[model samples]
Target: MATIQEIKIDLEEKSMRTLLSAGTNKDCKIVAEGDSWFSYPVVKDIVDHLRQMGYAIKRHSKPGDTLENMVYGTDFGIATQVQRANNYGPISLKETLRSVKNLKPKFVLFSAGGNDVVGSELAQYLNHKRSGLPLFRENFFRDSVNGHIKSAITAFLEQVWQVDSGIHVIMHGYDYAIPSGLQYELAGIRFAGPWVLPAFARKAITTRTEQNRIIRQLVDIFNELLISLSNTYPNFHHIDLRGRFPNEAQWHNEIHLRKEGFEQVAKLFHQKMVEILNYNPVA
Candidate 1:
């Protein structure tokens, strides 16, 4: 496996035309964007694997960015908070646009919006009746969450299509996350999340079994939304990762994966990319 440093060298040395070339010196220019999922070693492994197969890559993923920031603007006050947990700085939609215009990639790999729904928005979906509050608010999905996500995705893609309608946008629906409140220790600080797990406990959704169900419901909603968008947009392709990793061992923390875990998921992404692009560098 090549280090991120080595991958950086490849990204810098490759040109857009050469990256798009195929059959002789086979290569494809891929713009990788999104969340900590892509910022981690999982995406690193994916890029390295693609490089070994002769694909040139340029990654613009930010470790703690959400779809809002990536498309709208940076308003997440916690942007500076999790620096130690995942080190890449914020990259806004404007910055992403700048790259798209400059690089003219064949495909844009995006992974985001998980943070938006995972944090405070999750509580709205829960049945808080055990706390003497009302049951699940039926209007919450339509009035708040769904429209917000749909609009963000629509606008994000609209902007990308405007840049170049030829660019195929690749995105994935995250696999279900356990409400385990698992923490990973790095540099003496313990970073554990989905964050909603602890939030669930605070709000009296105490049972692990119940927490898991609620979390799964939330994951399903988001994944369904992605699928719907794929159906709506011609250039957009969605990869459903719902059942890709069934074992709990795949999740390092509540929201992240271990190295081998990332490798497994990366292979899935690679397979889907090859299928959509119809150009297999490995072959």
Candidate 2:
């Protein structure tokens, strides 16, 4: 088995053309796109673990990407703008689809929607405690998840099918996160997150129990949505990661897991991949 550093290809640092010329077997090639779960800067993430399992992964994920931007955003001048602002280049799912067409990878791993649900836009979905309304504006939350996120996912999958109908699309519902108010920091520099806590504070829902309940409900709903969406596509597979990291010790921060936890999650992904490849045996 190749080490993570040997198998993982950061797409930003290397061109797709160069990657193709490196003589990797297309059957073991994987294109991973989405948010920090796939590209966490502070620690080894799921993609790193998958690479150690022998997949040659071309990663196009960034730390704070949203499903909408990833699927619909263009490459033209957007990468420059995003790189200037975020210090990392933009993730273009269109470019990823093109890679899929060229590389003809057997599987595409997508990790998204977490940013869409818990990012800066989270406040929009919350109702103030003073309003005496539901914690979440249920209708708005449902509409955004189903209308925007789901639509973006569907669009990406449609493009993937066009590129290669036999390509398997693998997605994971992130495990339930603890809104512990712990922001991700590295070397005394705060990078990202405490994503859910501040929103809960602003809404005046400050109790730890209440925060846990709300986060669990949100994650559950998101996972259920993904599971339902997976059912509609013959080549799409959804990995249910709920309850996988049941302890606070497994989580590194609000939205990410510790390295060992991520490795465990990667094993689940590997298991699914093995099952698919064993049954189909990608030629």
Q: Considering every candidate listed, which one attains the maximal lDDT?
A: 2
Q: Compute the lDDT of residue 162 as modeled in candidate 2.
A: 90
What does candidate 2's lDDT look like per residue over 174-250, in tens digits?
98778788899988888777888898899998888877777777777888788898888878999998888888888
- Model 1 worst lDDT run, 10 consecutive residues: 82-91
Clashing pairs in 1: none
For model 2, the run of ten residues with the poorest summed lDDT = 6-15
TM-score for each of the candidates? 0.80, 0.85
Compose the digit string of candidate 1's lDDT tens values, residues 58-105: 667766677877777655333456653332333477677777787777
Give the CA lDDT, 0 to 100, for residue 117 in model 2. Answer: 80
Q: In order, what is each prediction's RMSD in angstroms?
A: 5.9, 5.1
User: What TM-score does candidate 2 reach?
Assistant: 0.85
| Candidate 2: Cα lDDT at 158 | 89
Q: Global lDDT for candidate 2? A: 0.80
TM-score of 1: 0.80
